[model samples]
Target: MAKYKGRILFVLAGALLIIIWDFIYYFVLQYSFNLQVDLLFGTLILFIGYYTGKNYDESNETVSAISKSEEKIKRLNEELHLVLQNITEVVFHTNSKGEFQFLNHSWEELTGYSIKESIHKNALHFISLHERHEFLRVLRRSISEQKEKTKIDFSFQTRSGQFRWGEVNIKLNYDENGELAGTVGTISDITERIHNEEELLEMNETLAIESQKLSVAGQLAAGIAHEVRNPLTSINGFLQLLRDDADEKTREYLEIVFSEIKRIELVLSELLILAKPQSVTYKRINIVETLDHVAKLLNTNAILYNIEIQTAFKQRDLYIRGDENQLKQVFINLVKNAIEAMPHGGNIMIEAGLNEYNKVELSFKDEGIGMKKQILDKLGEPFFTTKTKGTGLGLTICLRILRDHSADISVQSEQGEGTTFSIKFEAAHQQERKKREQTQKVW
Candidate 1:
């Protein structure tokens, strides 16, 4: 009876333990506590899980954005390198005190110095010492004014110890707020460009010489033809004399010879001026008197073109020491050019005034077909003419004469507008002119 009573107690205790286990298994282990037996472990695991998931998403997004940014930067760097690769000219940046700050691949290649060597290098070392003060003054002024573009020519010694002429164009570098930053410019290897231009000029000069030679040849041919024709004329006269007594057929042949001889003389006479250039006798003559004379000579043409010819000769006596014939030629050429330019009637303004330097400035402006810039550049070159029937030597000869007389000429022409030629000579007092002439004689 005691054993049965003990077993019954054991069984009741076991049933109570099972009910407690079942109560803890589903709800406590999953929600309140874990199998680790420490209540703190359950709390720690819950906090860690939520935080790790949030951290992982944020990190992944940040990494992806950073990768894209890196790719963009790499592409830009490649583009910059490619653009600067083939340039042979020096491209650089410098500060106010002539310290080099940035230099491109061209600057490195041209100077044979790396960017590291160029940094903090004085630009004065590159530019000439004599022009340094003047040079910097201009640069600073232009920068301070925030001039967008300014071009200046300077001579500099390169890293190779060679002097080079650089035509540098600088623009004021400004920040976002319009404050001056520094100067940025490109240094072109104008050495080759200049050399080629000089070569081209030399070649053009050679062509001019050849053309002059041809002109001489033409003159020689004309002179020889003239002499031959004169003898032939005499021979034809004798033939005509014979023909007077000869048969009809003989007389006809003689008439042909006589006609040919006369035709030859006309062509020869026109070309004789080129063979024997006329020497000028310069004299100090009053120009007003000659201008009066020119008025009468050009009157016919002025009337023919229905052009209004006007003169403004109010000065007492403007004397010039030049050949009368040559000066007349110059005036004639100018007037003719102006008249031709104005096919339709247009006003021609002629003014004689004393320049600021007191030089005798004679201006002839015509409202006519003006010229292009390209044409003006080679204005005095022989054979460059706007006229279809122009010999093209008129302006060339005029320029030569003006230069010989120690005078200067300036011309302004524009397309479809008008052309103006300003002629200047030393308008020193008559006494001063004599003094200069005497000084020249003594020297």
Candidate 2:
């Protein structure tokens, strides 16, 4: 409305000026005024005024629109920055030379390096030395192939000197002339995922190997028991009959023969167990009590060997789902092994507690002659042992029993430093909760 009024006033002013000029030309100059010229000048002045006002209004509108557009752009930029700052993955930009040009807050969180300090640093600097070459090779290959985007997984060094897995996704950028400008990308922390995949793969391989071994052992055990048991039984019966009528020296020889036969019987029994494990009745059993019982049962044996058996529990009522007798047998075997490892006298530390994952963790640590890597790797194999008279089936049987109870075992040892066997089991409460969830799902 104001603009219209201004345009009207401009026209009126222009007409008034033109009329005053006409009067001055007619009266002051004493000349005849031409009506046609006056009318032409008035019309031209009106047209000029209207044209100027129309352009002024359009100019104002253009400026207002520009201001609004600038404000919107600024707001969008701020939102983009906020998203980049809070995301868990590191978003970054680099120059053609692979020098970092920009990095979001997540880079600092992942690498422990300040954004200010990390700028202009080479991307390869953070990668592990062994993996840097491969990283660069893949990046160059993608560029050479004229690929717009690429992904690579590599191990990168963190600020604390630890290497972690990172999956990098890169998008290439170019200048107006289509020449390479730089690259924008994201780095995701995939360390946990990678470790989990590796563990799963290792477990699958181990299960396959174990299955094959069990199959062979089963066939062997069946054949050996069928062919050897009857003859051994007949020979033992005749030997006992002959021993009752023999002299003192002959009786002593007969007793040794009886002991050898008994040892053979024990081996056969263990083989059978390995071939076909007995059916187990799993129940919620207190792990603390089981460990305590095993410790007490072996306490006298440890004492005679100049060894001390110690027990520690973080919680008194820690429980797990397992067969009680089988679990006790497993613990006994581990404790006995610990006692045997230390010939000169040492401490056998048995500890039970809840781990970070809320699983029941039980460990047997012994201060003794620890094994070399090659020997440790062979553990759990049938007929593998370090002891002079060991049949090597003890640990194999213990491993099978623990597997039946759904336990995970790990061994850590260093020559001259001693060994620790750690076992983890799902807590009884957790097991019950999982069952309930499955039941709910079924319903």
Candidate 3:
């Protein structure tokens, strides 16, 4: 009766029992039953049947609830096991003591350990011996600050005792009070990624080496050509003296020898130009004046060949900062090629203007037979030529010079119509020098 839940029902039952028993004993049982002792047997039978039925129902319900709870737990455990088995990389959970408490099947496969072996050892034991010190440093730092998560790249020793790089991500587990409890993490093999990075680094290093080799080859050739100049001058002087002393018949033969030597010297000079590296010597040169001078030199040839040569330039002075000789060479090659292409005295137009970015834009147009796409692609490759008795070095040298100056060039042409060549030089830096009145402007 002291217990509230059971007390109320038990008290009600007792009150009913007393009233019913008295009624049965005094009225029906007392009169009908000749024996007074039959009351105890009737009451005992009713009490036993009622208590037994209630107890049985309550016990059955308790058993059913327990069975359902155990079934749910089993289902969840199986799902977790399947998930752990599917991953390719390793996965594990550990307590603060560094003992493995849980692991995926990958952990066993990667480390060659059965579940029994892994549960006793910490992750530190699985790492490569050489990388242990570094890993220990990272682990200690992570735990000291109570870091909730950590990502680290390190080497791990596999079951076969080979080193493999891994990218590990670990999260700290905490209790309700935010106290550190343990850690759970995933480890991914990054051995291939690391190897690729190293390979790329090696390739870049090789490119630098190739560039240096090309430079050395150029220097050696230039030195050899310079040495030949002295010998070449002596030979030319003797040939001239011999021609002066001889008769016409023998002189003609000497002249031929001299001409051949001169041709050899010219070849030497071309090689020197190719091998000698250019030093950047910038000076302020008027583009209009340079073009005017070049046109005048070629003007005679234009007339001799009955060609129409014309120039259209901007009114204002357009100056640029560049090597005088190299820039002149580029223009001369363009103009000469234009003239050569137009064999039948066609028009050669040279145009110059400034672009929006304050860059100089120059174009050479010629009424000549245009080239095909295949020829255009190989135009700047050394030793490629269509002209008979041509050295084939002119355009190749032009390409190198322009590339060195960081200038731009483009060509447009149509078959049987004409050809046009364009050059664009950035003048923004020149504009800045003009605006700021840089002291180097005079040059």
Candidate 4:
């Protein structure tokens, strides 16, 4: 409508000018009407109207194109803002001086720092002190190499003053002259991933050490069982025969000898368990029932030692796939250790429940004298024990049994603060289905 109005106004003004000119020529100039002059004047007016209208249409098209482009740019900016606000990772932009220029909503969510307050602050300030040097080195190296993109994993400090693992991917921005202008990057929370990786690496190291111990045990097991046990058994029989005829003083010595022989036999048996693989019956067994039986069996022993044993379970029907006897041994060892730790008679709390992963978790927490870090680290090693009479193989055998049942064991202890042993196993249903799938695949 507006474009047409401009054309209409031009045509009207041209027609009015032609009328005035013709009137002047006929009335004021006192000249007779000339057909050629009127025709030429009318033709000139039409030509001017056509030329002005064409120019107005072209100008209007250019204005419309500019308006559409601006609208497109506005829509795009809105979409970008929405994405940055909703993403889980922190999106950021920094100037060449490493000062923050822009931060998205996730930055506040992750670091507990408001975006408005964080802007213009040095980004390196949020990185852990120990990692800052490495971060700067990486940034400088990227710029020196003229790399457009780079990545680094660092510990990022939050507003609460705790550090979390973050993996940052950076894309360098440059001016037209190729000088560094700033950087755009995203930081993702990798705390869980880093923890899992550390656990896996520690587990691998532990397995390597256990493998070496097992090799040594295997070499010693067969020799000791066959070459030494037979003679010891014969000598034990003789000692018992002689014990009946010995004097009181001699009897005391014989008793000590008998106890030592029994200790040796116990050690030999545990070595066999650790060094050799036994037939395991994998079936769904109620873990609650197993734990209850262990508790009952040890109740008398615990009472004699001036200790009390308590049992608690989140559910009544907790089940797992494992050999009942082997599982019982593991629980018994852990409970007994707890009982022994508290010589002055403290309570041992045995609890079972489902963990976050939906796996069965059984924990034994004891109010007893705890171990130091060095002793705790050496817990599962062969011949490692804190007790005077311990064969040092009991806990190792328990660990081996649990490992065969696909269970994980962890211990926490602080000097004078007591200790807790936690064991995790796959739920019975999950384990059963996993085995069935494996069997089917094998067939």
* lDDT per residue as tens, model 4, 1-443: 77676577778888888889888889999899789979898988967986797688778888999999999999999999999889999999999888999999999989999999999999988899999999999989999888999999999888888879999999998889878999999999999999999999999998897878877876788678888889999999999999999999999999999999998998888777777777888888999989899989999999998888899999989988889988888888888889889989978999999989999999999999999999998998888889998878888888878878879999999999899999999998887798799999999
Model 2, CA-based lDDT: 0.90
Error of 4 at 116 (Å): 27
Question: What's the C-alpha lDDT at position 418 in model 1?
Answer: 95
User: All candidates' TM-scores?
Assistant: 0.45, 0.64, 0.46, 0.69
In model 3, residue pairs whose N, Cα or C atoms come closer than 3 Å (at least 3 residues apart or on different chains), thus clashing, are 284-443
Clashes of each: 0, 0, 1, 0
Local accuracy by lDDT, each model: 0.73, 0.90, 0.77, 0.89
Query: On a 0 to 100 scale, what is the lDDT of residue 143 in model 2?
Result: 78
Give the alpha carbon lDDT tens digit for every residue of 1-443 in model 3: 22233334544565577668668777876755434455565566556645654565566667778999899999998887788779897788889777789888877666666878778687788777788798879887887787899988888776777777888899988788766688888988799999999999998897566446546645755886878888989988988888898999999899789878876776667667777777768777777888888888888888777777799997458777778788888888888888888878878998888977678998999998889888886676545788875656677678668867668999898877888998887664675566577656654
Instruction: Please give the lDDT score at residue 411 for candidate 3.
Output: 87
> Which residue pairs does candidate 1 place in steric collision?
none
Taking all chains together, the TM-score of candidate 4 against the true structure is 0.69
**What TM-score should be assigned to candidate 1?**
0.45
As for lDDT, the candidate ahead, 3 or 4, is 4
Q: Give me the overall lDDT of model 4.
A: 0.89
Best by TM-score: 4
RMSD of 2: 9.3
Q: What's the CA error at residue 242 for candidate 3, in Å?
A: 5.2
Displacement of the residue 282 alpha carbon in candidate 1, Å: 1.8
**Residue-wise C-alpha lDDT for candidate 2, range 1-443, written one tens digit per residue:** 85475467677778878878888888888888688987898899888877776776677778878999999999999999999999999999999888999999999889988999999999888888999889889988887777899999999888988879999999998777766789999999999999999999999999898879967877788788878889999999999999989999999999999999998998888888877758889998999998999999999999999999998899999989999998888989998888888989989999999999999999999999999999998999888999987888999889888887789999999987789999999999999999999999999
Give me the runs in candidate 4 sitting further than 4 Å from their true place: 33-51, 67-206, 241-247, 436-443
